[model samples]
Target: MSASLEKGIHALKEQVDSTVAAFFSSCVHCGMCADACLFYTETGEPERMPINKVEPLRRIWKSEYTLLGRIGKLFGLTKKVDDKLLTEWETLVYDSCTLCGRCSMVCPVGNDIALMIRKTREGMAVAGHAPEGLIGATTRAITIGSPMGVKLPALQAQIRHVEESTGKTIPVDVEGAEYMLLLSSMEIMNFPEFIEAVSKIFDRAGVSWTISTEAFEATNSGIQIGVSDLAAELVQRIVDAAEKLKVKTVISPECGHAYMAIRWEGPNLVGKPFSFKVRHILEVLNELREQGKLEISSRETQKLTYHDPCQISRRGGVINEPRSLLDMVADNFVEMPDTGKMNWCCGAGGGVSSNERADEIRLKVFQRKKEQLDAIKPDAIVSACSNCRLNLEDALEEYNMDIPLLSLTEMLADHLAD
Candidate 1:
């Protein structure tokens, strides 16, 4: 190896050492985390087990850092790290697993495997082994505020279009607004009607809400890219905007990953706790329902099944609010077998929807979810995450399945009192 290559490898080893130390220190291998893992249950392979899922990293820790490891290395008993090992680790870290934290929920030790995976990703990123889609999204987020690269000018134009369509003057950074409405770029590009829906809902509810074209996007590709610094920077934009606007609440729009970044990890990413509250759109609508501000007319008589976005429902602990809204809007709501927090992923989480190389793998991963939906025979599938919608749409198109996808905001807007 060249001197530069050696230096790079040494630096990566240091990172791996630190990350593995943190991971092993956090997990006790109690086996509870396995119960929540779908891959383990589906394949019945111990190697694919959740606790066992971290073994590749754990082996590196044991062979490099632990006292026993040094002795084993001295005796040539421990495996040496090499390019082949790195390749295998790469597949396990990126392809064989999704960063869904169902395992974290069942862990008695509160060991966040997602964090470990992210740390692993950091090391892989240093080695230039990250997925193309993740790298692209991160680069875009760093260059522009959002992963989709929707700049200030485009965002303002989209906002204008939404205002024109709704005929409602959506406030932008109005001084002392009660809420700062954060939107994801996906809605702006593919589902602009969601923007209109939110504006109409807020207008009808008489709630003071403003959108910040300056900090327009809530989508954090940093988390998707596994870069903590980039994630922190993207999160700071929202924090600064909220402080500047003096909004009491930061209402995230209908996107799962955005909600997770803002609601669950925003406080941590910002370094200190935020004084303002963060709520998902469904939560806001539920609050409006409780206040008697949101009135629903007769339900639309159509078959519908809801797909739970992993980030929002599983990670952010928001499951019932959207379903309650769906129940109020639809006459017939069919429950999928694995509904709520336990539901299967739409195979679009963790930035896989944008990955060209992983597209086939993603489609194959959704076979189980498609089976569930086909069993219900629903006319429409209601979901909150933009990525989920994109993946499901692609799957429907690929399999020639005939189910229309709708966002919760769009569905509720249909039943909103005009």
Candidate 2:
């Protein structure tokens, strides 16, 4: 092997050793996590099993830290690490697993496999083994403040377009506002109605809110791409904008990953908890409902089923608020068998939404979710995350299935008193 490749292999081994040790130390391996894994059930491959999924990492850990490993290495009972081995691990770590963390829920020892995957991603990134699509998105976000590469002027133009469509003037960076609304690039570029809905809701509620054209986007492609430094830097932009606006609270638009990045991981990413409170749109709408700021007199008159975005439902622990709002708006609300925290992933987690190479696998994996939606035969499908919405849209197109996609904000906007 070339010296560069050999060095890379050694570094990867160290990373695997530490990450696997952490994961193994946290796990009792009681098999309770088996039921939570979709890959295990779908493929029935023991290697694909959640407990066994970490075997590659475990082998590296044992080889490095155990006495048996030392004896085996001295005697040549175990094969020496090589380039082929590193290549295999690269595929297994990046392409084979989705980092869904359903396993953590059933783990008796509270081992967070999702964190292990993320740490593994750090090693892969250093080795330049990351998925190209995610790397491209991260590059754009670093350069332009959003994955979509929407600049400040383009963002302003989009906001203007939204204003023209909805007849609501979205004031940008108003000083001393009670709230600063943060929008994901998905909303601004692909789903402008989500932004319009948020504006309409705030306007009808008589709540003072402003948008920051400077820090307009809430999408953190850095987090998706597994770069901690870049993720923290992007989050700091949002934090600085919030401080500048002097808002008492910041409201996130209807995007799942955006909500998770800002609300759940923002403080940790930025090294300190934000002084201002952060909330998702559903939470905001629920508050509006409780405060009598929102009134829905008529149902949506459509049969609808809700797809729980993993970030919002599992990571963010927000399952009920969106359902409550949907119940109020939909004439008939049907739920997938595995709903709420237990819901199946749309196969778009961990930046897989943009990975073209993984697109086929993503669709195959999401076939389960598609089956659930087909069973309900709903008029529309509602989700709180942009990635999930986009993935589902693709799935619908791929399978020749037709289901309208609506964000929770859009549904609430439809029911809002005009």
Candidate 3:
């Protein structure tokens, strides 16, 4: 009843709409996706190919939906979806693939292989083939309102610290603010300086924004675990808060998947568009700069490069906003090789970081990002996503590399006009 081959096949059948069918039909087997994938490229494993990860879904769609597949199924010639097949694909789909969409970009036939992977995860999760770490995180997210189990009181303590540090009172539940800010649990726990930095910058820019005690945790483990029901429940908390507080806009903090969850997938999962506009915090900062509200006192002297979070840049189209903000405060900014929309993933996205079993392979696959960093050899690395920053720091320490990881917002705050 919990996770069976019959349930997985049914989920796969339901997921294979016209679009998935078209992608399966159009895939020319060029194998370009293999090269574009970090796991495949780093390990030289054929099973890690983006197209191959969703083979079960493709085979199910073919046999059940397509004419030739129906004949094959009638003759018992089509590949069957079984426990063994699902067992073999679990690691490839959950641990190796971050759903970064780089393969989608590189597809010669314009196949959205990454989307298929995301869809394939739904079946995997229902089949009880999802990673245990992700399952625990999803449970925490739905039951405790945060994947990390961060409670409102924890955020309250952080707010008090920021308020005392910045001499600016951080607002909470103040009706009719111009913007509502959402922070990832990581920011609350590891990088409280983010809240302090945001408070100072917003004070300087004369912006009115408040943190939501109702839904402060922006990271959606449900999305990472590929469960829409749980994802929608997590998103609705923010919607309820935004509406209750009557905020004009909701600013997604510097978490890649968090931004993607609320800004891109929130409405779709909830079956309606948001009443207030959702902007990545970088986008909001850039808008402030465009309005001539953001003034910088000086520029960074140390040479630096950006590690673009794949969701914010490639998937969300917030490419120029971060660079534009960086230009205002960083004097010696340089591009990492294959930076921007085509940048490499941190290998810990899409709930991989939460999955303890993925630790070894995650670090191994990070060679792709390590190569990108080696090519640039920048003095410092700046990134918008806290998850990417944390992963980069870990990998840097692992390689004994000397580099400082800086948050784009924190860096900007340091150079604020006095």
Best by lDDT: 3
Q: Who wins the TM-score comparison?
A: 3
Give per-residue CA lDDT, model 3, range 23-67, as digits (tens): 999998889999999999999989898999998898888899999
Per-residue lDDT of 1-418 in model 1, one digit per residue for the tens? 4443344355445556464586687776677766665555544555555666455456567777889997998999987545555555665566545677777666777777765665566555555666777788888888877787888788778879988877788798796899888888888888888888888888888999888866878898777755666888889989988888888999988888888788887887778998789999889988898798988765768898888888888888889898778777888999898778778777667776656666666777677687788778999999888888988998998989988998988788778887
Return whichever of 1 and 2 wins on TM-score.
Answer: 2
RMSD of each: 3.5, 3.2, 1.2
lDDT of 2 by residue, 1-418 (tens): 6665555445546556454676676777677766666655655555555666445455556677768887887887765555565456554455556666677676777777766666556545555667888888888888978887778887788888989988879988898898888887777788878878888888889989998876878888777666777889988998999998898888877777788789988998899989899988788888888898987766788888898887788778888998888877888899988788878878777787767777766777777777778778899998888888888898889989989888888888878877
Local distance difference test, candidate 1: 0.76
Q: Name the 10 consecutive residues with the lowest summed lDDT in model 2.
A: 4-13
Evaluated against the true structure, the overall lDDT of model 2 is 0.76
Clashes of 2: 1
Alpha carbon deviation, residue 49, candidate 2 (Å): 4.0
Better of 1 and 3 by lDDT: 3
Q: Using Cα atoms with residue i matched to residue i, what is each candidate's TM-score against the true structure? A: 0.87, 0.88, 0.98
